[model samples]
Target: MATYEEVKDIPNQLDKYLVDVRNKSELKETGTLPASINIPLPDLEKALNLPDEEFKASYGRVKPSTEAVVIFSCKAGGRAARAANLAKTMGFANAKAYPGSWTEWAQKEGK
Candidate 1:
């Protein structure tokens, strides 16, 4: 699992992928974590499976390798955890969930 602090600094980490599992509507309503990409839970598996070039064309970001550090976040964490587990099952050993997610992030950051 990932804590709010860890998620906050993900941008500085450079290689880490902070994936927000919330739907695009939710992100428009509540905003999203700094530097996190929107990859809704329902589409996450297929997104992760996309080839590198295709993934980049679709999401405008490179596809994370199986060993990459991929962290997931959602409204209150449920979907984030589910996404992380799914990534792990698909061979992403470093997948993790940000339990505090958007709720805690908004509270702490006063967004």
Candidate 2:
């Protein structure tokens, strides 16, 4: 699990597939990480696509095309870590969990 600062600094470098596992209500209330795609744990597979067709075409991107570094974040660390592990089992070689997710980000104020 990466710390908030550690993850935040290089988040853009990991833009290929950053998945935020926060629930819809939480996302509406607290917002999300930059370039993060929301895919609740239950809907992960279904939502596993490029951010959008326009962006994908312009950026020369496609999802599930490679074993990407999929970073997962939830309210706290638990769900994200679980999602990361699950992603690994599902063949994503570089899945990581941001343990200090929005809860810690909110506490910092600058995030």
Candidate 3:
């Protein structure tokens, strides 16, 4: 899980990598972080089958060797953590979960 400090630093680090796991409804309701790609968990199975060339074409050449960190985020911490763990198991060694997800972001946005 990412700390508060890490969340604060995301904007700067985002240029390198960031992935948003919120569903379509959630994304439509709330704006996402800059450069964050929407990859809903339900769609993961389909994503796995995407041709490597297609994946690279769409997501900018992500190989097992890609150095960018993959941060998964959802409404709350739970789903994001699950996605992060899955990503790690699937060879994304730098996957991380943002505990302060949309719920926290929404609360802060109100203030």
Candidate 4:
């Protein structure tokens, strides 16, 4: 699991990808974390499987290699945990879940 401090420090870390697994509606209702990419949990598998070019076109970012460190976060961390497990099954060796997630972030950041 990842901590809020680690998530906050992500912008300075080039090897980490902070992924928000919340759906679009939720994100619109309650903004996402800084420097995080939205990849709704439902679409995560397909998104990860997309070709490099297609992935970039769809997500506006490079596809994460299997060796890349991916940190998944969601509303209350449930979906993030699931997403991390899913990524691990798909061969992402360093996949992790942010247990405190957005709720903690918002509370801590006064958002």
Weakest 10 consecutive residues, lDDT, candidate 4? 9-18
| Candidate 3 segments exceeding 4 Å error | 45-52, 59-67
Global lDDT of each candidate: 0.92, 0.73, 0.70, 0.95
Q: Which residues of candidate 2, in runs, are more than 4 Å off? A: 14-16, 49-61, 64-66
**Residues 3-107, model 4: lDDT tens digits:** 999999999887789999999999999998988999999999999999999998998788999999899999999999999999999999999999999999999
RMSD of every candidate to native, in Å, equals 0.7, 3.9, 2.9, 0.7
What is the C-alpha lDDT profile of model 2 across 44-93, one tens digit per residue? 65455336574456334456444666778899889999888888777778
All candidates' TM-scores? 0.97, 0.75, 0.75, 0.97
TM-score of model 2 (CA atoms): 0.75
Q: Is candidate 1 or candidate 3 better by lDDT?
A: 1
lDDT of 1 by residue, 1-111 (tens): 999889989989879999999989998899878888898999998999888998999887788889889999999999999999999999999999999999999999988
* Leading candidate by lDDT: 4
Ranked by lDDT from best down, the candidates are 4, 1, 2, 3
lDDT of 3 by residue, 6-91 (tens): 65567777444556788888888887765567778877545645787776676664532334577777888888898888877777
TM-score of 3: 0.75
